[model samples]
Target: MLEIKNLSYRVENADIVNSVDLLVPDRSFMVITGPNGGGKTSLAKLVMGISTPTGGSIFWDGQDITALSVTQRARLGISYGFQQPPRFKGMKVRDLLEIAAGEHISHDKACSYLTKVGLCARDYIERDVDSSLSGGEVKRIEIATVLARRCKLMIFDEPEAGIDLWSFARLTETFQEIHDRKEASILIISHQERIIRLADEIVLLAGGKITAKGSVDEVYPQIVSDTVAGCNRLEVKGAC
Candidate 1:
C-alpha cells in the first residue's frame, strides 16, 4: 500500500498541495481529477519523488520513503510517466524499451508493448525518439516504456493528452488489462471520463486539497452535475 500523510508542497508561500492525505491500496486503480491547476500533477510528482514535499511523509509498503531520491524510489518499483514526456535524441525505440525493462526484451515482446499503445512496432522499433516523432507519438511511446517497466506502481500524468481517438480507445483498454492482472497499482491524473470510469476509486482534488474521494458510483455523478459552461470542466468523450 502507498500511504501519504499530511503531504504538502508550497512555493513562494503558495500551497500547490496542502495537508493532503491519501492511501492507494494494493493492486488498485485510482484516478485523480479536478479543474486545471488543482495540483494533480504536483501531487503525482511528490509521490514519485520528482518533487520534494515541504512537509509530511510518504510510505510505501510500510517503508519510510519520504527522503528517498527519484532514482531510489524507482529502484523500489515505482515508475512515473511525465505529462510532457522527454525525448532521447539518439535512442531507438527498442533501446528505450529495453532500458525501461532493465533487460534485452525479445522483438515480439517489444512489439506487444508498442501494440498496446496503438503503434506498429515494425515502424517505430528502429525509429529515433527525437524531434521527428510528433508530440502524441512521443507521449504514447513514453507510455509504452512505462508499461515495459512493469513496476509495482505506475503513475501516469494525463495519459490521454495529445492522443487521437483511436489511440485513446486502445490506451484505455490497455489500462483495463493492466488493472485486471492485479500486477501493480495504477495512479493516473486524467480528466477523460473513459479513463475515470476505469478507476476503482476517484479522488477529486481542487485548490491543492482533496475535496472528495470515493468509488465511481459514489462520486462520478456529482462530478458530472458540477460541469458548467465557460470554465474548465471534465470532458465527456464518446456516447454516455
Candidate 2:
C-alpha cells in the first residue's frame, strides 16, 4: 500500500502540486486524470521521486520514503515509465530485457513480454534501443521492461501516447492481464476514456488539487459532465 500525506510541490513560485493526500490500496489500479497542466504528471513524478515535494510525507507499507532517491524507491518495488522514454545509445533490446528481468530469460519468455506490447520478438530482440525506433515503439519497449521487472508498484505516464489505434487497444488488454495475473499495484496517469474505465478508483485533479476521488461510477460522471460543459463554454467563445 502507498500513502501520500499532505503532499505539496512548487517550481519558480508556482504551486504545481498542492497539499494532496491519497491512499492507494495494494493490488489495485488507480487512474489519475485531469486536463493538461493540472498537476497530474507532477503528482506522479513526486511519487516516483523524480521531483522532491516541497512539503509532505510519502509512506510505503508504513515506512517513510519521502526523502528516498529514485533508485532507492525502485529498490523498494516502485517503477515509473516516463512520458518520454530515454534512448539507449548502444544497448540491444535483448540486453535491456535481460537486465530488467534480472535473469537470462528464454526467447519464448522474452517473446511473450514483447508480444504483449505489440512487438515481434524475432525482429526486435536483436535491435538496438536508439533513435532508430519510433516513439511508439520505444514506449512499448519501456512497458515491456516494466513487465519484466515485476515491480510491486508500477506507474505508467500516458502509456497510450504516441501509439497507433490498434496498439492502444492491445495495450489496454496487456494492462488487464498484468492486473489479473501479477496483482501488482498499478497507477496510470491518462486521459483516455478506455484507460480510465479500467481503474478501480479514479482521482481527479484540477489546479494542483484533487477535486474528486472515488470509484468509477461515483466520479466518472462528474468528469464527463465538467468536460462537456467546459467544451461548450469554449465553443461559445470561439475557442474550440
Candidate 3:
C-alpha cells in the first residue's frame, strides 16, 4: 500500500502540491486526475522522488521513503513512467528492456512486452530509442520498458497522451489485463474518461488537494458536470 500524509510542494511561493493525503491499497488500480497545472504531475514526482517535497511524509508498505532517491524508490519496487518519455540515442529497444528487467531477457520475451503495448516487436526490437521514432512509438516503447520491470507499484503519467485511437484502445486493454492479474498496485495519472473509467477508485485533485474521491459510478458524473476546476469534462461513452 502507498500512503501519503500532509504532502506539499512549493516553488516561487506557489503551493504546487499542498497538504494532500492519499491511500492506494494493495493490488488496486487508482487514477489521479484533475485539470492541467493542478499539481498532479508534481505530486507524482514527489512520490517517485523526482522532486523533493517541501513538507510531509510518504510511506509504502509501512516503510518511510520520503528521503529516498529515485533509484532508491525503484529498488524498493516503485516504477514511474513519464508523461513525456525520454529517448536513448544509442540504446537498442532490446537493450533497454534488458536493463529494465535487471537481466538479459530473450527476444521472444521482449517481443511479448512490446506486443502488450500494441507495438510490432520485430519492427522495433533492433531500433534505437532515439529521435527517429514518432511520439506515439516512443510512448509505447517506454510503457513496454516499465512492464519489463514488473515492479510492485507502477506509476504511469498519462500513458495515452501521444498514441492513436487504435493504440489507445489496445493500451486500455493492457491496463485492464494488469488490473485483472493482481500483479501489482497501479497508479495512473490521466484525465481521459476512457482511462478514468478503468480505475477501481478515482481521486479528484484540484489546487494540489484531493477534493473528492470514490468509485467511478459516484465520481464520474460529478466530474462530467464540471463540479471542479482543472477537470477535462470529457463525454461519457458506451452506456457509461
Candidate 4:
C-alpha cells in the first residue's frame, strides 16, 4: 500500500504539487489522468523518489520513505518506468533484463518478457540499448525491464506515448496480465481512454491537485464529458 500525506512540492516559487493526500491500496491498478503540465509526471517522480517532496510524508507499507533515495526505494520494491527511456550505449537487451531481474534468467524467461511487449525475443534480446532502437521499441523494452524486476509497486509514466497502435494493444494486454497474474500495484499516467478504462480506480489531477478520484464507472464519464466540452470550446476560439 502507498499512503501520501499532505505531499507538496514547489519550484521557482511555484507549487508544482500542492498539498495532496492519496491512498493506493495493494493489488490494484490506478490511473492518473490530466492534461499536459498538470503535474501528473511530477507526482510520479515524487513517489519514485526522483524528486523529493518539500513537505509532508510518503509512506509505503507504513514506513516513512519520503527521504529515501531512488535506489533505496527500488530496493524496497518500487520501480519507475520513465516517460522517455534512457539509452544504454554498451548494454544489450538481455543483459539489461538480467540486471533488472536480479538473477540468472534463462533465454525462455527473457523471451516471455519481451514477447509481452510485442517484441520477438530472437530479434531484440541481442540488440544493444542504444539510439539504434526506435523510441517505441525502447519504451517497450523499458516496460519489459519493469516486468523483469517484478516490483510490488510499479509506476509507468505515459507508457502509450510513442507506441504504435499494434504495440499499444500489446502493451494494454501486458498491463492487464501484470495486474491479473502478479497482482502488482500499478500506477499508470496516461490520457488514453482505453488505458483509463482498465483502471480499477481513476485519479484526476489538474493544476497540481486531485480534483476527483473514484472507480472507473464513477469518475470517467465526468472527465470525458468535461474534456470534450473544453476541447470544443478551445476549437471555437482557435486555441487548439
Q: Report each candidate's C-alpha RMSD, comma-separated, in the order given.
A: 4.3, 2.8, 4.7, 2.6
Which candidate has the highest TM-score of all?
Answer: 1
What TM-score does model 4 achieve against the real structure? 0.94
TM-score of each: 0.95, 0.93, 0.94, 0.94
TM-score of 3: 0.94
Q: List model 1 lDDT by residue over 1-240, tens digit each.
A: 899999999999999999999999999999999888899999999999989999999999999999999989998999999999999999999999999999989999999999999998899999999999999999999999999999999999999999999999999999999999998999999989999999999999988899889999988987877665635344332313
- Candidate 3 lDDT by residue in tens digits, 1-240: 999999999999999999999999999999998777778899999999999999999999999999999999999999999999999999999999999999988899999999998998999999999999999999999999999999999999999898999889989999999899999999999979999999999998877878789999998787778643543443212323
The C-alpha local distance difference test score for the whole of candidate 4 amounts to 0.91
Give the winner by lDDT: 1 or 2.
Answer: 1
Clashing pairs in 2: none
Q: Which parts of model 3 are misplaced by more than 4 Å? A: 227-240
Could you give candidate 2's per-residue lDDT for residues 151-198 as a string of tens digits?
A: 899999999999999889888998998788756999999989999999
Reference-based lDDT, residue 166, model 3: 88
Please name the candidate that would achieve the greatest lDDT relative to the true structure: 1
User: Which portions of model 1 show Cα errors greater than 4 Å?
Assistant: 232-240
Q: In candidate 1, residue 26 scores what lDDT?
A: 91
- Whole-model lDDT per candidate: 0.93, 0.89, 0.91, 0.91
